[model samples]
Target: MSFNSPLRDEELISKQVFERMVDIVGTSHIVANRREIMSMTEVLNRSAIKYDVPFRIATSGSMGEGFRFEESDMDVMEYPDGFQVIWDHSQNQHKSFSEGEIFVFDGSHSPPGYGLLQILSPEELNSSKLLFVKYGNSYLSSTFWKKTFLNPILGSRIHGPCISSNLECLDFDYAECLISRCWPPMASTFLSRCQLWPNPQTLQDIVNKECHLVPIGHKLGNHEEEEWMISFSLAEKALVYSMNHSQFLLYGLMKLFLKEIINKGLDEEEEILCSYHIKTAIFWTLQQGSSLECCQRNFLKCFWVCFELVTKWVYEGVCPNFFIPENNMFLTKCHGSAQRKLFCRLNAIYDVGPTCILNWLSMQDRSPSLYSYLRGNTNDLYIKELYNELAVFALPRYLNFQTCVRMLKSIVKSAPSNRDGISALVARMTYVSMLQHVAFQLMSLKKEDYTRDNNFDELSCLAIMQTAKLGSVSDLILRAMYSYRVKKYPEALFILKMAKVWLKQPYMIHFGYLDTEYSSEIAACPGNSLLEVVIKSFVFSIKLENPIFYIDELFTEQEHSRKNHWSTIFIPPFVLLLMLEFLCYRHVDTQRAQHALDELFDLMHSNQDSYLTSVFQDISWQILGICQEMAGNLQIALYAYMKSLVEPIVNRIRSATLQRIQSVKRRMCRI
Candidate 1:
């Protein structure tokens, strides 16, 4: 039988929808593999932190769920370490953290999915924080947490439960939470309905994981100021991954629907419906034994089924939170006339049916829609976005030596399952390159046998192995940097000459690689060759977190720069390749050095192809200014520094830019 056996020939539109979805979001295995890779990255970063830090920071929400919606802020939850939320007072004897402060909660007064945190620790300890109110007991007020996050430095403001910060490239919403070790009694009933859907093992895992209490009280609740709403974020993330590819795609499509269709042109406060409502509807549908109903062939039917569920909830004015059936998610918004408005809108869209999905953007104001590609020939090639997304899986994670070792083992073990997938192959090459990085870092460390040739040979072997697999450009540039560092100018120059030749290849593809001729024929191609070049020839950046490759000239004044908050720093590969070119040639030949310097300015100033400045714009500009200063172009250096300052200031080297500006001004006065 054919794969579309469940779909009828008369249902041509449904079949097209299913195939288009496959092109938009790859095969189920591919999406699941990509999700695993992303989850692995977050886990590695969390583990890489110091053991004694008081807080545990994690990415939650849509970004962590492997979904990136436009303008949707990345959600990061920072909760107290050592313990978890929805915790029963009984688990205090777990002995894991018995010596530490214990925060028992009272759910008696608050609603089913919300609780009041009672500081069971010493009275003196609770006095210091001042976040507690004497409402019969020393209960923590979520209002206090709101005030704490309101310190305006940059463009940070309170957005619901989170403190939204405008980072240069990405906007982040940080929600401070308290973890409860035990599962909430309120959600205990949700497990009983799990028999048909989650399977025994997955259900057991959900029971074992911790839940959290986000700092927002139910607005209509009596203890509005103090109540902390229970969050099943940890459990939700697990459930989302356990979903079949069809379900995941439906969820993604539902999100797009909520954003583009339901909320289109509506002010934030005016849009009563939310993604959570849609998620709860899907979760209930899955538990009610509709899991198998979701399939690639009849996904449109499945989407409609889920949509009807939401419409029913809107009309009833009682959208149940999946975990705690008593927690009416629509309590505040979907009521009376508001409910009538939402129901009418969803009903009209329901009546229109597939046009709602296919004409999502066009129906609004004739804008381009995601389904526009579906209107074209399937074999006409647009690189099928999901695999293009897979390119990032090979980039190094935020890791140290030990974590890199663990990351390496994990990547290697998962290799067999991925088979011929581009991401898996790139991942294999990534682990080898990770070893090369470790060896390179070993060169910078002090060793008693510094004179021994063993370390050097081992390092050289790994470098050559990487060179053989993914071109010799990055490793060659790294070698030249080291050679120039130890005063081997002629050797460095020769290595760079080889690197320059390798660099001349047409730029390798990464995210946002193709220009706006995006729909034109130029963007239509790059399928197999794109994968081949990215795998075997592209210059993959050695993330600073990995510490594989280094040059002294790359750093700003270390002591003055507060780079700790920066999760990872991206200095584009081209900046390193050409910057070292300038340094190496300056020692050997003035004419060549001048030529390299000219190239540096061009790369920095030009917003052209061949180099991606979008990700590391500020850092690249800063590097150019540093090189200009070295060349005694003080005025031009100041101009370049100012350009770096103009970009977003969140993770960039702003202090270094400011200090350098002062240093240049002082030097100019001395002249």
Candidate 2:
């Protein structure tokens, strides 16, 4: 046949066959079949148009490619309605009812007693005025009925007109057609049951067939294998059917199991197994339907299962712990479904990750599945973002300043984007700054028992302050250290005093070793000679000649050599005292200056130690004495100056004064 001829020939054959079909089965039934086909075609066409997908139709039975116009065969070239073929076969195709009759046609023939019998409901049989013909024992009703119709499926085979096969003598019915579609044991077993009938057995007889004797070995195959084949074939068919008509497959499967359950009244074990299989089917549907449909039709059943599972796990304490064995299984299934749907929606290939922060939060409000698990069901929201953001909501929560600083630092350091994450870090730092200010104000209050709980608030507040730079805290701490040197304990009191006003409680520090590394360095080098460079490098303006504040001064030459006796012990602390003094009061009033000089003298006398009185030291004392005299502590100031002049630089001091005195005397003589 030419390529185009096959098309023309198929059209010719289809027309001739359909006309013959109408003559025997009548035009009304053919029209009904046409209507059914049209409806299904429209559904397919619309879906194909919407998804922009190619369309292919396949047969639903074991007719292979189906007879020329078999139940499965459809002419789609001039589709959506009438044929344009020139040949009209309805009139001349069949000579009479018996010869060229289309009973299991497509060139296939039935035995004398068996042929195609139109299975009709009481209403259809009663209303139709179509002619009826006797074939075997069944009646082949005429096609031209008022309201009667034909269906492609009378259980299994497609019954469209002009369909036939090469087999000349086989006969069929719905059940036989159904059996023919199966392999081995099912077919033979079903046929054997029909053999027992007294009269000619038909398809209905096979459907109504029941078992009395045990199945034979060869007939059933290996029981396990048979069972496996049954389940496997069923699933294969379900998937194939699902590809074309998913809801129909679902309905069929659901109906079969439901009928089995109702008829057999499943025992406990069977009930569990049946329920489990049904549940599996539901999950399968969800997996497949995610892309095919929106699942609105599947919602009613899925919602019940989800609600039951979640509520059971949540309430009545069947599984008291948040995580339980059964609960995990259910959750896994749900999460799998969610992930599948999510993947489809994103059009992603590999398993996509979970919802983003915003999407998850939205789900919490809108999705019952999310709400049940996140809100009432389990404490674990599985949300990393919410926990990370908890610091924002937490209030009056005691967090040490060091802790606050550390947390903020970490947040800023790790953040990858210049978005919400960075903004949050900035907010934390601002809060810390506010806390520091409050802490300072509280310290300024200066209650007597500074260690009281109220005092702790101010210190606590300062502790929580977040800082991008360390310089601010460094300045405050250094000042506090000086105040401690002068016995101005209240000034240093701010360090721990502000805890009460703080948002969080303060952390306590237990003072340990008496000396630190910094202290040891200062003590080892007592004079400015050793410290000048370090001081300049650090740019800390401390003068060595200043009076010792917290430090204990010693006047012995051997003082540096002395071990840990009372006087010797004073050296390190006393030096620290002088540095503290410089730090607190770099410049002081004259009386206080003189008093500092007097304290040095007393210290020297008590120690019974004296060494080189440097010119600098003598001059420093003299200046202090003059400052005191200027302040009108004339007697004491004069005494201080006289003592200073009589010390190690005595001869120089006398000579200088005598020169000034002689100069005055000469001026008088001249007059």
Instruction: Say which candidate scores most in TM-score.
Output: 1
lDDT of 2 by residue, 1-671 (tens): 11223443433433332232222222332223333333333332332232222322222221111111222222211111110111113422432332212222110122111122322222333433443433332222323321132233212332222122221111222110111111223233333332322123333332343211000111212221111111112222222223322233333233332333221453433222222333334433443233334132432233233323323332222321111112222222223444344224323311222111112211123223423443442322222122212212111122333433444354445433533232332333334433443343344444774655455643533443322122222223334443444455545444423311220112110011112323334333445432131211111111111111212321121122222111111111122222233323324444444454454445333531111123233333443444344444555555555655565531123343233235434544666
How far is 461's C-alpha from truth in model 1 (Å)? 14
Q: How does residue 394 of candidate 1 score in lDDT?
A: 45
lDDT of each: 0.67, 0.29
How many Å off is the CA of 9 in candidate 2?
Answer: 48
Give per-residue lDDT, candidate 1, residue 114: 80
Cα miss at 336, model 1 (Å)?
3.6
Model 2 superposed RMSD (Cα): 42.3
* lDDT of the structure predicted as candidate 1: 0.67
Question: 76-164 in candidate 1: lDDT tens per residue?
Answer: 78876744443666666653663445677788887778878887754645445545666667766687866764454455777778878
Estimate TM-scores for all models: 0.77, 0.15
Model 1 spans > 4 angstroms off: 1-10, 50-54, 84-99, 123-127, 130-136, 145-153, 166-168, 290-292, 362-472, 475-479, 506-535, 541-569, 601-608, 612-622, 633-671
